[model samples]
Target chain A: MQELVEVRWHGRGGQGAKTAAQFLAEAALDAGKFIQAFPEYGPERAGAPIRTYTRISEKPINLHCGVVNPGYVVVIDPTLLSPAIVEGLSDQGILVVNTNEPIEAVRKKTNFQKGKVGVVDATQISLDTLGRPMPNMPMLGALLKVVPLVKLEDLYKNIKAKFLKKIGEEKTNANIAGIKKAYEQVRVG
Target chain B: MRKVVAMTGDQAAAEAMRQIEPDVVAAYPITPQTEIVMGFAQFVADGRVQTEMIPVESEHSAMSACVGAAASGARTMTATSANGLALMWEIVYIAASTRLPIVMPVVNRALSGPINIHCDHSDTMGARDSGWLQIYCENNQEVYENVIMAIRIAEHKDIRLPVMVCQDGFITSHAVEGIKLYDDKQVKEFIGAYQLEHSLLDIDKPVTYGPLDLQDFYFEHKRQQAEAIKNSLKAIPEIFAEFKKYFGSAYDFIDTYKLDDAELAIVALSSTAGTTKVVIDELRAQGKNVGLLRPRFFRPFPKEKIVRALSGLKAVAILDRSEAFSGQGGALFAEIRSALLDEPKRPLTVNYIYGLGGRDIDLQQIKSVYADLEKIVKAKKVKDLINYLGVR
Candidate 1:
């Protein structure tokens, strides 16, 4: 495809935005495509966190800057609903927010352009499968359905790079389940 | 040998990076610094420079990846402004202490209190003690030259410290200036092929970098970096000599304009240098012997050089971007005072805070700074109004 596709991932510090990036990078490797994966941070001790992103392409990635204006934005935490974050997302951008609310309900809370919103009970899914509210993996699954740049096999590789051996395999399987479930729930325009 | 082309400071730095052909460049582009990485990526994509540009998500990853690459014996580079610089602050210290010659072009801008994307020294001042060789440039030419010099300085045998070539955000980074571009063959001859040593990527040896320095060794490890910085001061003149020989246009620790027989002087850096120069020249043409001392090298602070130059002068005025929060003085003022402490007769050095938060300081206002210097010279004592000149 000649068109560029970008994914914006929102998460807190220590929330696996970095790990999520690793998963996406590995996934691109799996798909035999080169990838760009990284994070935006602050002093970011424990409580304060930030965003990360991924771009997978059959050709070598040429973009060297941050995802200032993105085609897709993934919010792993509901708390990051700031004016700046909402403002950065493009008009036709797909938003994959990791809250338990249905896409319609969260749409009502914010004045974000309505047509391309994807909401998932990612927190609920994480709590169910991973036994925590860490939506990085689940959010990645949700992102696959929303962000068109990267593929499922790419994400699987991303999971491998992040978790590594045995625990990684289990996490990988769990993430695949999360992605599948999230994929089913999201409504695309 | 002197050719001038108009370009932004960011573009100049990127062009310099293109000449060096670093092995890896990981950057999260923010405003001001965005053009730099973008231009460098162009070089990589065009096959003009065979290098890997790591497309990281944030300034933190950008710097972290630079550390990883430099440790692995790759010549690494990156660029960021304001918020991006702040994000990379934590790792900046590590890059320096690890003694990896990673160079970052810091487009100096104010930190957000009111969400500004304009020029100031706030971002870089915050990074002062990050153990990086901090160099400030007046315009695009210095930004272009310093980036090349930074790699040479950082990779020097006696000094392998990380370097921060600070340029004013919009004033220099985005502002177009007529810069002399060097030929590829000439630049290649200047910045020779990088030789990797004790690198992680060396498969034969397989060495580990960034070992945790415990309480006993921590101070020593830091001392080593400090020593590297100190030694860099000695090595810089030699490198710059070579730079001048190759490039034809020379540089110095400080550029002094007409202070020889002048009674008053204005000491400053960055784009303010241009402002001060015009003001001084105007005052001089009108038979007022006023000079401007623009510090090209900020790290070793050019203390002896400044004292030698300023001691002969009757009075001096210092300008700063940020408030010291210490007294009726700026950070550069305080540093100058500390430097001139041993001098037999220190000049009446007054302090001024101007052009903060992206407020434009035009020629008219810059001339007023010279008037203040004249008043300070007459008073024979340093005035400490802690003045804010630009905006409300």
Candidate 2:
């Protein structure tokens, strides 16, 4: 296993992409991995393009800049997809997209030929399970399929513990369902 | 028992505040710094602490309230960033001159004209000589520990000065990372209790604070304050040793990463040092004698130790996150250049001002810095002495 793995996330504001990255880092920490997760801040507004990053390692992750050449690029919004999304992805990297499109089509559309790709119908999954179009939780589920950096069981426990009080059990359970559904339904190539 | 948890720098600092439970927290929300005071405010709301939460109208008012609270002999704290810190500039100096031990977590942000709320040292660097003790951290864990340590450092009788526990805004402030946290009991026991020696509220032994001091005693009072900061050099090691004995993380005024026998080195502060360390490891593997020196204490400057560390090196690059625009170099570059004046084997030194307005400093850029150092070493002379890195 690689000692360090860097992941970049592309999404729009208010989509919880930052939150998903936070959860991923926290879950990796739960698994005893040193992790850093942060979102790029700018004069960005809701539904505008934004970026977030995560770095997980067996040792304390010391690099403090943004993730430029990422081992995994997780796109939380299908509309935000572009060739630039995978511009600096490592050759052995994996790109995960939250789209209903087939894996082959996502690869073709993004022109992400350098790395392995995964696609999930996260929008549909979120609408089905979460009763909304928030793709953040589902995207994390798809990311888990591409890179087992954190355990799903641990993520679930974390989600429950962090959100159970503020968001209540019902909404937390919905997010958990959204995660599981996306995990099972994601197609990797 | 200690708990290991994943959290951001702001959250971690707030957690430390919760443990310390200072008498007052005067705060105004600013980007990047908002999370810290917000988290602390929640603690106040939930009655997790007995802190008097003063939600002031503005940053100036926030600092003013802090000065008032501290003068009344309360263990005082407040947080701000960028313009917020700028707004509190007047009171910031007074808090120090009055010898009030108010602690503040300054989320490092670029001061504005273009109005950016990003990670940079400009905020704290601008206040370097404001009579406050400044400590920078590379990550969330360090920020947490530094805030806890800042309390002791600020309140020390020998070093009764305000302290700024700074971490990179957005980078470390917002970034979630795994950190080991001491138990509440452990933290409480370690910090012990803060007892104010002089209080305006002490009717029987009253003393005036921030009173009108005309030129007659102003210079003398300032000299005394300067002497107090200089004396803090002795107090820091004592508190640092005690902290390590109890908490098990030994910290020093300056942290040297692989600098031993290094021909070239990079000097930086805050999160940039973390990235520079990665570059150092990569170069070390390639048999390059390179290292990094991060100054944990910036106010007292750690002049003697820094001079000793860079004396024998072939070349050194001082990286500054804030621009002095002095046409010479950044503030750090100037200080370091002055410090190395008496060194017999002074390394060829250059300044690289970088990461201003939260610009991303990749590993390649850090490598280029070392490459520049190598060139300087071979040429036996420095060229373009003050340069910019990761900037067009």
Candidate 3:
């Protein structure tokens, strides 16, 4: 990983975009790296579009403004994929989406030709594993496949430790299963 | 042993409050600040702290309850944001004038009209003269540290005043970052125990709290309060030194970043200062000789420390997150300019009223401010006394 890696997550309200960003940052912190995570708050309601940011670095992060040029953009809701979503992404930045569509189709939708694109059927994966439509965990799995900011095992340990108490054993295991499935199935091109 | 944990500024404040384990916590929930109340409430529910948590009806009631609890000789604490702090205005002043050592973590937010719930310094800046010590924080770690230190500052023998530990709403309050927390035993030992000299609950010696001394001693009493604040200027350093001895991180009224030999610098506060440091580093990498001076304490304004830090600078841009509406400039700009009046060789300073109403101030905007400072250094004068940055 580089000295600093900034990731922006685009998701709708109630989809856990903010949670995913925080989870990634916390996992980075557990791995002995400095991190920051925050959501761009607005007049938000359920199903409303929201953006969250995560920054991981070897050194302390001093920048407090919104992440403008993110090295990676994760779109948890496939409906949010657009040219605007790719705006301000670095030329070499990677875009990951939780869509059942092929990587080519996702790239065509976002017009994000500057860098590689990763696609995964995270919506289906979440439904199959968690028995619910929570793509946040699977989307994070897809993101790590492209960037590998934190090791998969470390992220799994963090998620299990963080969620087991709040979500209980069965749901926590299911969430972890979804992550592993998405990690294995995500296709990047 | 100190523990490093990733938490938001609100969480950090609550964690500090948990460690302090005040006798009473009377607060009403407000956005950005709601998390602190919620986090502490969880601790209370989980039996982590022995505190009487009061879920007040309104912010007015919150401050009123805090005043009551504090006067009764119970170590007290509370948390609120923009409108919440404004709503507590009446009791807020009373809490300070009555000299109750209440500590409140004010998550900075813009006051309403159009009714915005976003990051701004207008809330606490408005209460600048409410006779409370105001300590601004740059990040979650600072938020945690400042809240702990405020207990000592507010409850000091010479400085029996309330304190508002302010952090930028959402910017730091909601942002999660790694923070180092001291052991509960260490914090307890550092703060010791609150022992009010004249407790209202003391039956043997009755004391008057809010009495009307119309023409006789009101002026004299107010003078005593003024002296108390001034006394803090001397007492705060000793407390800070004590904190450093225990925590290993030194704090001061003002924090300077590479400003000693720099020709250009930016003066800012809270999270904006953190962002400015990044810009300073980038500019310094290109040999721009730029730096930053961040004021940690706003109330009892650290004029001497600030002026001393910017002494050798050729020019500076003072960034204000809230407008003073004085047609002169923002509150910080006014304070900085006034502080430089006595200095024979002071930096040519310009005021940039930016980030009002929670508008994002990016690195480019900060860099541009430095660029303006460089221009001012060449011109040897400021073109505009008050300029707006990142504003439409």
Candidate 4:
């Protein structure tokens, strides 16, 4: 891992993009890493495009501006994929997408020659396990597969503890299962 | 033991409020600031703290309720942002002049004509002269610490005034970061109990508040208020010393970053200062002698400290998040320039108004400001006294 890891999340409102960023930061924090997570807020309603950022560092992170050249970009909405989504990403960077398409098809759609691409059927995984189309949890699992910023067990523990109360035990268990499945099934190219 | 937790600036302020648990919190929700109130309101609902949460109809009523509560010898607190603060404009001054020790966490946002809700210093800068002590925060930790410290600063026997703990709206307020929170008992013990000598509810020795005194004594009362705020220049350090001893964290009126040997520097406030630090490091690696001076307390102005910090520099740029429209420069530049007037060897200073209406101030922009300062020092003069940075 780099001295500082910056990740950007592109998702529509109500898709839990902001929450996913927060979860990543919180899990990083629990792992004794300094972290920051914030959303680029605007006058946008549900289904509107939104971006959130997460930074994890071994040292204190001081930069307050939005992450432009992120080392990793997570796209939770497959329909929102475009060349703009991969802007500022380096060839060495990683792009994680929540999609049913294979790596070749996803690469053709995004026209992303820079960096590696990881694709997963997050919508199907969430539906099978969570009984819904919320892809944030599975996206996190895919992100960890491509770039393990935090330990997989640590992320699982943090998520279980965070959601077990707000969401019941059954849903939390299903969410954990979805994450584990996505982590195993993510196709990176 | 200090608990390390991940929280946004708003949550940090709310957590501090929960620990302090003032007698009254009268607030109306506003975006960015809405979370602080809502988080505290949750504490109220959960019975985590013994606070009378008043869901006031408007910011006007909010401040009015706070003034009434503070005058009645109750420790009061509140939170608001841009237009909500504008709505509380009338009572904001009254709360100050009445010598009510109210602590408000102001999430700095742009005042609206187009109705924008994002980070800027315009909201608090507009109230700079309202007699309330304003302390700008750099991050979530500073937000948490300043809110906790403001309680003591405001309620101090010598300095009985309101305090605005200002943090950038959505920038720090919405951004989650790791912060160390002290134990609740230690915090409670540090703030101690609110001790009012003479309160409105104290029927034994009643006193008048906000009485009409047109020309007869209004001037004298204003003078007294001025003196009290000035006294904070002395009282604040003492409180800070005690806080440092108790919390093991030292705080000063101004934070200077790598300014000791630097010839060029940027003076800014809040989160921008953090970004400036990153730029300063990058510049320093390139053998450029540049630094940053971030003022935490903008109310008492810390004129002498600011002057001392920039005394030996070749040139300095002052970054203001709000455009003062003074035509000359922004609020910080004007005050800092005035402070440097008496100094014989003050650095050549210019003003850069940046980040208005929540425009992001990137590291590159800050680097350019340093680059401009380098040019100013080389020319030994400033071409433009007031400059707009990052504006199209």
lDDT of 1 by residue, A19-121 (tens): 6764665565455555555555345476575777665556543333345677777778887765456656766677778776666665766567554887787
User: Which DockQ value does candidate 4 get?
Assistant: 0.92
Report, for every candidate in turn, its global Cα lDDT versus the true structure: 0.76, 0.91, 0.93, 0.93
Q: Using Cα atoms with residue i matched to residue i, what is each candidate's TM-score against the true structure? A: 0.67, 0.98, 0.99, 0.99
Better of 1 and 2 by TM-score: 2
Provide the RMSD of all predictions against the true structure, rounded to 1 decimal: 15.4, 1.2, 0.9, 0.8
Q: Which one is best on DockQ?
A: 3
Put down candidate 2 lDDT per residue, B11-69, tens digits, no spaces. Answer: 99999999999999999999889999999999999999999999999999999999999
Interface RMSD of each: 15.6, 0.7, 0.5, 0.5
DockQ for each numbered candidate: 0.01, 0.90, 0.94, 0.92
lDDT of 4 by residue, A1-189 (tens): 688999999999999999999999999999999999999998779999999999999999889988989999999999999889998898988899998888887778878875799999999999999999999999999999888899878888888888989999999999989888999999998
Relative to the unseen true structure, what is the C-alpha lDDT of residue A31 in candidate 1, on a scale of 0 to 100?
54
Best by lDDT: 4
- Candidate number with the higher lDDT (2 or 4): 4
lDDT of 2 at B95: 93
List per-model TM-scores for chain B: 0.96, 0.99, 0.99, 0.99
User: What's candidate 1's DockQ score?
Assistant: 0.01
Candidate 1's residue-wise lDDT over B92-187, tens digit each? 888988888988889888888788777788788777778888899887778899999888888999988888899887666754444678887788
Clashing pairs in 2: none
lDDT score of residue B378 within candidate 2: 88
lDDT of 4 at B243: 92
